[model samples]
Target: MARPKLPISATILVKNAQDTLQECLDSLQEFDEIILLDNGSSDDTLTIAREFNAIYGNLVIHTSEFIGFGALKNLAVSYARNDWILSIDSDEVLESTTLVRLKELFGTLDSKDLDSKTSESSALDSKNPKTPQTPTPPPNTLYALPRKNLYNGEWIKACGWYPDFVTRVFHKDYTRFNDNIVHESIMLPKDARLVRLDSGLKHYAYDNITHLLQKLQTYSSLWAEQNTHKSASPLKAIVRGGWSFVRNYFFKKGFLYGYKGFVISVCNALGVFFKYMKLYEATLPKKPRSCSLIITTYNQKERLALVLDSVRELAVLPTEVLIADDGSTEDTKALVESYARDFPCKLGHIWHEDRGFRLSAIRNAAIREAKGEYIIIIDGDMILHPFFVADHLAFATPKVFLQGSRVIVDSHTSESMLQARSEENAYKRVFTLGGLKARRCKILSHLVYATSRVDSKFFAQKDFIKGIRGCNMSFFKADCEAINGFNESFIGWGREDSEFVARFLFNGGALRRLKFAGIAYHIYHPENTRDMLESNHQIYLETIHTKAKFCRYGLKDL
Candidate 1:
C-alpha cells in the first residue's frame, strides 16, 4: 500500500529557545505543517524559526506575548490548518519510528468513521453553523507517547522519570489545554481513548542543578499564586516535602540512579517545600482593603436610580460604585451618568449587549473593572438601608463570604414607595411584609449581628441556600478569582447565585449570614418567566454533584 498522506500539523510554543529549536524542528520534518508561536523571544529563536521556514515551506511562525502555557498552546492549536495536532515542546525531539507508526495508524483509521463513533448523536450540522461550539474529539483515539528525560548530560531513566507518558497527538476539535499558568495539561472528554506509541520523545528538561533550581522557583511561584484560596502552613509544608522525598526516592525506586537520584529526590522535596512556603507568605496580613459596591441592573432605570440615591445616604460610602448592567438601554446609561455628576464616590458602568439574562457575565465584567480589593454585590431593585456599607465592612473577614437576606416589598407597597421619594416610606413598606422575621430584622437592623457558619459539606441545603441571595452578598476579590467568579454558562436567573455560593464554600471560603446588618428592601417586580429555571437548577445540582470549584467557562475563559 502507498504511504498515507497524513495531514498532521506539528504545533510548538517557544520563548528564547535558540539552543534546542533546530533539533526539535528537524525531528518534526515528517509533519505536513509546523506552527511556531514565539513568545517575545529576545535571542536567535526567531532567526532559527525563519531559517527553518525558508528551508521547509511547511513552517508557519506567529509571534505573541507570553501567556500561560495552556492558553498559548490553545492559541497555537487554533492556528493549525489540519485537524490532527501533534503538540511538541521546544526542548523535546520526536522519535523517527514514532512518526512512522503515527502515519500507519492514520492510514488504517477512517476519520469520518471515528467521528461518528465518538461524537454525540445530535452533533452540530457542519453545513449550517450558527453559534460557536467546542469541537468533540473523534472516537477512541488520542496518541500517548513515552517521554525520556535528560538531566545535565546524562539520561536519568531510573529517577521516576522514564516512560513519562504524555498525550500529545489528538484531533484539535476534541481536545484543548486547561488555562493554568504553569503545569497546564490537556483536558479530554470522559470517554476518550488513548493509544500508546512504541517509540518515545527525548526531553532535555534541565542542564544542571542551577537550571533545575531556577525552574523550581518559577513553577513553585505559579502554583502558589494559582492556589490562593488554599490554606498553607509551615508544618503542612514540611510534612508534604518529607513525604515527597520518601515516595520518589524509595517507593518509585529512584536510588538506582545513584547520585542523580538523590539530587532529583532532594530537588523534588525542595520544590514542594517552597510551594507551600510561598502560599503561606501569601496569607500574611496586608493593607486595609478598599470596597466596591457592584449593583446589578436590567432595564430598571427608575429602580436603579432609587438604589443609587440610597447609596448617597450611606453612613459609610464605598470607594467606588460599579453598575453591572445586563444589556440595559441607553436611558439606563444616562441615568448612571446623571448620578455620576455628584455621586459620593467614583462611579463606573459596565454594560454588554442585551442577550436575555447574562447576569453572571456582566457581574464578572464589573468585578474585573472594579479597583477595590473587596466587592459588595446587590441588585438594583434592592434599595439599601443607610448602614449597609458600614455593616458589610465591619463584618468583612478574610476568606469569608457574607450573605445577607432581603425584605420583600409587595406590589402595592412598592408602587406607593416608588411614587413617594422618601426613605421613611420605603422602611414603612418593608415593615408591612407578612413575615415576622423580615419585620424584626428591618426594625432592629443595627442591634442584630451576623453569624458565621462554614458548610464543609459539598451539597448545598435548600433552606440554607435560599437565604444566600446574590441581591445582598460580599466577598474578597481573591476568593472570587479562586472559584473563577461565577459560572457564565448560567443563562437566565435562578441557581447562579446558589451555585456560586456552593463553589465559594467548596474552595474553603467560610460563609457568614448577616441577620440584621447589610439590610436591603427588595422592591416588587413581576417575576421573570421561569422557563429556564429548571434547566439552571439542574446545572446547580450538577455543580453540587461534581463539587466543582472553578468552572471551565468562567471569568478566566473570557
Candidate 2:
C-alpha cells in the first residue's frame, strides 16, 4: 500500500540529467507533487521523466524557455498549489532518514491557517483552570538540511563537501531564489526564520576526471562572466590557483583521502584557474600555455626524491606535477604528500595497484587527470637540468612530439653530481650500466649549447621510431588523445614506448629529436629483465604492420 502524499511540492531544474534523474525523482515519492522545469534536453531525460509521471501520477512536467537557474526555479514553484517548495538538484537524492524528518515537519506545518497560534499553557494555578494563555505559532518558513557530496561514488568528506547545509524547503510566499546566472541562492526576508533539518541529501558531485573537468570548465565560464568587472592576470591566476590547491589539499586535510582527494584538489584549483584565465582572455592579453610534468615511478623514493629536488630548481616551472605511481608502497605516497606541502605548483599522486609492469596504464590515468594542454613525461629516476622544461616548451608545437636524450650517471656519480662536487670524479664514475650505449656526451653538450646556436636545433624524425627513449618525451595532450593514449596491451616495459611512437607516426604525427638541450641525468639502476620482451615485441610489430591509428584499450577505457 502507498502512503498518503505530503502537502509539500518538490521542484527540480534539469538539463540532460539522464544519468541521475530517475533516482532524484524516486526520492520525492512522499511529496504531494514533483515539478520538473526542463529547458532543452536532447537526451532521453524527458522520456525517463514521462515514464515516472505515468507511474506516479504526481509529477508535473513543464517546458520553459532557457533562463537563469533562479528564474526557472521561481517559475516552477509558481505552478504548485502548496506554498512550501522543496528545491533539489537533478544530481541530489533524498536520504531515507531525511525523508522521515521531512514528513514529520510537513505534518507539523500542514495547517492552512498559518497565522493561528496553538495554546500551550502547562502552568495552571491550583484552582485557575479557566485561565487563558497566550498562543504562539510554530516558526517554519525556510529549512536547511545537510548534504554529503560523493565523487566517483566515494564519499568525499573533505574539500568542503561534507555537512553542506542548503536551504531547500521554503515557503514560496515568504522567500524566492535570487535571480543570478550561477550560484543562485534563496532570498530570505529580514525577519524570516530557518529550521535545521536532518541531513539526507546525497550530492553526486562528479563521476570521473572527465566529468569533473567538464563541469569546472562550464561553471568557471559562468563565474568569470558573472565577475567580468574584476581585474585578473596570468600571474594572479597562478598565485591564486596554487593557493587554492594548498588550502584544499593541506589545510582541509584532503591528503587523508588519497588519490581521489589529490585529483579533487587539483580540479578545484583548476576551477579557480580557468575562471581567472578566462577572465584574462576576456579582458587582458593572451595567456601562455600551461604545462604539466608527469613522472613515472615504482618504489624508488630515493631516486624520485632526487628527481623532485632537481625539478624544484627548474628555470621554468610546470603548471603542475603528477606522479604516476606504479604500485609503490606507502613511502612513495608519504614522500609525495610531504613534498606537496611546499611544492611551487600543485603536486598530485596518481597510483594504481601493483600488477606487474603496467606503465602505459598508469601514464594514461595520470594524463587523464592533467589540467594542462601540454604534458612532459619523465622517469622518476631522471634528475632534470634547470632549463629542462624551458627547453621542451621551446619547440613545443602542434602535431609534434619531442623525444629528448639523457646523460646516464652511475650511482656514485649521481650522488655527487648535484652536490657541487668535482667534475673529473663525476665523469670518471659515468660508466655503461648495461649492454646499451650510455649517452655521456658531456663535451658535446657544452660545445653545442655554447658555440653554434641553431634555431630549433632538433631533427624531425618523421618515420623513425627506433632508439627513441620514453624517459624524456613531450607532446600535446590532444595529440596523445588522438592516438587514444599508449597501447595497454603491452603489459611489459619493453616496447610500450616504441609502440606508442609508432602509432603516433602512423597517425600523421611529426616526431622531433631534442638535442643539446632538455638534458636529463639518468640515475643508474639495473635494467628491467627481458622476460616479456618477446611478447611485447610481437605487439609492437603488429602495430607497425597495420599502421594502427588508435589502441582498443587506453585512455577511454579508464
Candidate 3:
C-alpha cells in the first residue's frame, strides 16, 4: 500500500541543471508537490524535468530570470502549492532514511508500541493495525538538517564538509532568505523555534576538478562584488588565505582525508584569497581613482591638440594623463609640454624611438611608466565625451575588461572641427558635427549615449574578440600585467587589440561591452597601413589555439 504524501512542496532554482535534476526530484516523490523554478536554462534540463513530471504528476515548473540567489529562492517558494516548503538544490537529494525521519517529525507516521507486541505476534496482526497519514507541523517552526557533501561519489568529511547544517524546511509566512548576491541565508524570525534534525541530505556537489574551480571563480567574484568597502586591501587576502589552509588542514583534520582533502583545503584557501583580492581590485577605482588615461598618438599635433582639448572637458579627471607617443617629432613633444603647465591633472608624454609602427611596444612602455592601479587606454584621434572618464570609472570591474562605443566625425566635418580657433570651439563641435556608422567605423552603440550606463552582452561571448577598440577600453592594471600587456611582436597596425583581449579571455578574464556610456568621437583619417595585418592575425589565431595566457614580449619585458 502507498503511504499518504507529506504536506510539503519542494522549491528549487534551476539553471542548466539537467545532470542532477532527475535524481533530485526522484527523492521528493512522497511530497505533495515539487516546484522547479528555471532561470534562463539553455540545456536539456526542461525536457528531463517534464519527463519526470509525466510519470509522477506532482512537479510544477515556473520560469524567471535570475535576480539573485536569495530572491530567486523566495520567488520559487511563492509558486509552490503548500506553505510547508522544502528548499533544495538541483545537486542535492533527500536520503531515504532521512525522508522517513522527516515524515515522523510531521507526525504523519505514528510509532506503534511494538515493544509490547513483539514476543508472540504474527508481526502483521489481524487486530489493531497502524494508520499512516500526513501531519501538520507546529506553527512558527523552522527545520535545519545536516547535509553530506560528496566529491567523486565519496563523502568528504573534512574541510568543513561534514554535518553541514542548513535550514531548508520553513513556513512561508514566518521566514524568507536574505537578498544577497552570494552566500544568502534564511532569516530567523523573532521567537521562532529552530529545530535541528538529524536527517541527512546528500549533495552531489562536485568531483570534476575543472568544474569545481569554475564555480569557485564565479562565487568569489560575486562575493567580492557584494562585499566592496573602502578598506579592502591585499593584506586581508594574504592573512585570510593563509589562515584558511592552516585551520582546515591542521585543525579541522582535512589532511587525514588524503589527497582529496588536501585539494579541498587548498581550494578553500584560494577561494577566500581571490574573494578578497578581487574586492581590492574593484574597490580601488571607486572614487576619483589614481587612474592613468593613456592616449596613444604619433605625429598628428593638430589633431592631438583637439583630443587634448576634449580631455580638458572630462567630468571626472584622471589622476595622471599620459600621451603614449609612437615616434612623433619634436613638435608633438612641445605641444604636450605646453599642456602640462596647468592641465587639469598631472600630464606627461611617454615617447619611444620612432620605429616603423610600433603601437604595441609604445603601449607597453606607457604601461610601465604609468602609476595607476586602473588604466584607461585610448587613441589620440578620438574626441572624448564629457562623462567618458566618469563612465569608465563607474564601469570598472575586477576581472573583466570593458570595450566601449565611439561616434565618428566625417572627413569634411573633421577638417572643419580641427581648424577651430579655440579649444572650446573644438569641444562644441563634438556633439554638433558627429555621425555614426558602427561597423564601417569599427564602433557599436555609438548613438546611445546617456548619463546612465548599461552593460550589453549582445556582443559579449566567451570566444568573441572582434570589433574591439583599443581606443576606448578599460582594465585593471593587475589584469594587464597578468596577460603581460599587448603582444609587441605585431610590428604594424592590425589585430593587436584583439590579440590582447584574446589572451585576457584565456587568462580567465571576461569581456563586458560598455554601452550607452563612455562615448568618444573618432576624427576621420585615412586608415592605417594594414601591411602587417595578415601576420598579426596569424598571431591572434595562435594565441586562441594555444590558449596563451600571456605574451612573451609585452609587459613582461617592461
Candidate 4:
C-alpha cells in the first residue's frame, strides 16, 4: 500500500550562528515549512534566514529575548505549524536521501502500525490523556540518526566518534529539551520505538584548539556550578587532577589522535583538575574533614619540599601526613621532621634499613602507623590540587576498593623525578602498564613490534585505558590491606601496582575509575623503565595466570 503524506516542519533555534545557518536552512528546503527561532544574533544569520524565506517561501522566522537553550528550543516548537517536527542544530547538514526516506516513512503509517511502534515513537502517548486521537502512525515513532562529527579538521573514525546516534527527528509534542547550560539535547521517554536511518548528520565540532579551549572553559565553569556544594582539598585536587590526564592519554587512547588527541586529552584532564581546584578555593572551611596522607620516599629529598608545600596548601587539611623513609641518604628524614615540627597535620616518619626500592613494602609500613580512617597514598614528588582529598571522599563508595584518576604533568615540572629519567618515559606511561586494566607486557611487546604503525596506535586507544600514572592514585586503608598491599614479590617499578589491582579485581574486589574526577599532572622526565621490559615481574605474570592465584603469601603475615 502507498503511504499517506503527513504535515511536518523543521524548527531550529539559533543565536550568533551566522557561519552555519545557511547550511541548516538550505537542507530544510524540501520540508513543508522551515521554522527558525533567532535569539538575537548580532551577525547576518537572521538576514540569511530571511533570504531563505524569500527564495523558498515556506520559511517562517521568529524572534525572542535571549533565553536559555532549553527554553529557546521549546519556544521554537510552539511556533511550529505542523505536529511532526524535525529539530536540527544550526551547524547540521542533512543528506537528501534522509529527507526522502523520512517523508516515505511518515506516509505508510496505519493504526496497527501505531500499536506495533507505540514503544518506539515518542508521539504515541497513552500516558497523556490530552493526546488527540490520530491516524495509524508509521511503524517506528522515533528515528535514530547517526552523526559523523568532524573534529580538529578531521573526521574521527576511531575512539567512539563515528556513527554516534541520537534521536533528533521526532514529534514535537513528545520531545522536550532538558534545562542545561551546555551540551543540551532533546529528551525522549524510554518506551519510544526507534528506527535507524541510513544517512547521518554532519557535526563540525570545534574547528581548532582555540575553539576547543573556549568550549572547555565554558563546560568546566558549568561543572563547577553544578557541583557547588562539594568542598575541595588541595592534596586531593592536585593528586587526582594529575591522574585524569594519565588515564586519558595512555589508558584511554587519547594519544592515538597524536598531537591533537594529546592536547584534547590534556584539556580533559585539566577540566577535572581545575574544576575541583576552583571549587576547593571557594568552598573549603577552616575545620576540614580529617583524613591521613601517606607518602613513602627513597632518596627523593630534593623534591620532597614541593610535595610538603602542596600538602600544606590543601584546601581541606588532613589529620596526619605519614612519611615512611626507605633509607634516603639525602636528608629525607631531616626534611620531613622539620615540617613535622611546624605543621598542623601530625607528621609521622618511619626509617628503615637501606633496602632496594621496595615501594610496596615501604607503603605497607606507613599504612601500619596511619591514624585517620581514610588513607591516601601519593608519590613524594607529587603536587596537590586544592580539592584532591575532598573529591575522593565525595564519590567514595564502600564496595569500591581502589579509586583513582589522572592529571596533567610531564618532565617539565621536576627534573629529579623518576618519570623523567629517560626519553620513553611519557610514551611508556601512556602506552604501557598505566590504566586500570589487565594488559600483559609480553603481549603488548609482541604486538607493538609486529603491527603496522597506524594499527598499533589505533588498537592502543580503543583497547586500553589512556591516562593512569603511578604517582597520582589512592585507595582506602582497609581495602589496601585486604589485597595484601601491592604484591611484595613483584619488586621494583612496573606491573606491581597494576598486578595488585588485577589481583584485587579477581578476588571480588572492584576498581573504581575516577576518569573525570580525581586528576593529576605528570612532570616530564626521561623514562626510567627500560629495564622493566625484562624484569622478574615479567616472569611473575605466568604464575598469576597459572592457578588463578593472585597475591603471594610472603607478606600475608605482615
Using TM-score as the yardstick, the better of models 2 and 3 is 3
TM value for model 2: 0.46
Model 4 CA lDDT for position 192: 71
Top TM-score model: 3
lDDT of each: 0.81, 0.79, 0.81, 0.63
Q: What tens-digit string does per-residue lDDT give for candidate 3 at 1-558?
A: 566777888898899998888899999988889989999999999998899899988998999986889989989988877878889999999977667666665655434322222322212113323222337666577777678999888888888887698989988877889999889989987887776655559998786677779889999999988887545678989999999999999888998988888888888899989999999988774443579999999999888898888888888999899999999999999999999998989998999998789999999899999998889999999888888888788767667788887887788888888877364656557675433423222133333322222222222434444568898999889889998998998989999998888788767777777775787888889999889989888998787678788888897764
Deviation of model 3 at 176, angstroms: 0.7
Residue lDDT tens for model 4, 1-558: 533434677888888888888887777776778788887789998889888889878788899885566677778888888877777889888865565555445563445445444223333223333222344343237666777766766766444455587677777767676765545677767767666665658777667878778877777776666567776777777777778778767776667888866776677677777778777765642222456788767777755666676667667777888887877874888888788888867888877777676776777677777776666777775555556666555544433433454444545335544434334232223222234332223344334323412212222234222333456556556666666666666555666665555555555555555443343444444455546535745644543454223465324654
Q: CA shift at 468, candidate 4, in angstroms?
A: 52
Residues 1-558, candidate 2: write the lDDT tens digits.
456577788999989999999999999876889999999988989999999989888899898976777788899999888877889999999976566555555553334323332222122223323222212213345667778889999989897777688988888877899987678899878887665554559999899999999999998988787778999999999999999999989988789999999999999999999999998878752223899999999999877877888787789999999999999999999999999999988999999999999999999999999999899999998877778898888767666777778887766666665453223233223333322333434465445434422121122323334667889999899889999998889877698998887777767776667766787878878899889998998988777667787899999863
Report the C-alpha lDDT of model 1 over 69-147, residue by residue, as the tens digit.
8899999999999988889999999975565555545553344434434223223224333222223335446767778
Candidate 1 wrongly placed segments (more than 4 Å): 1-6, 108-140, 288-558
Task: After superposing candidate 2 on the true structure, give the runs of residues whose Cα lies further than 4 Å from its correct spot.
Answer: 108-140, 284-558
Question: What's the TM-score of each model vs. the native?
Answer: 0.49, 0.46, 0.52, 0.43
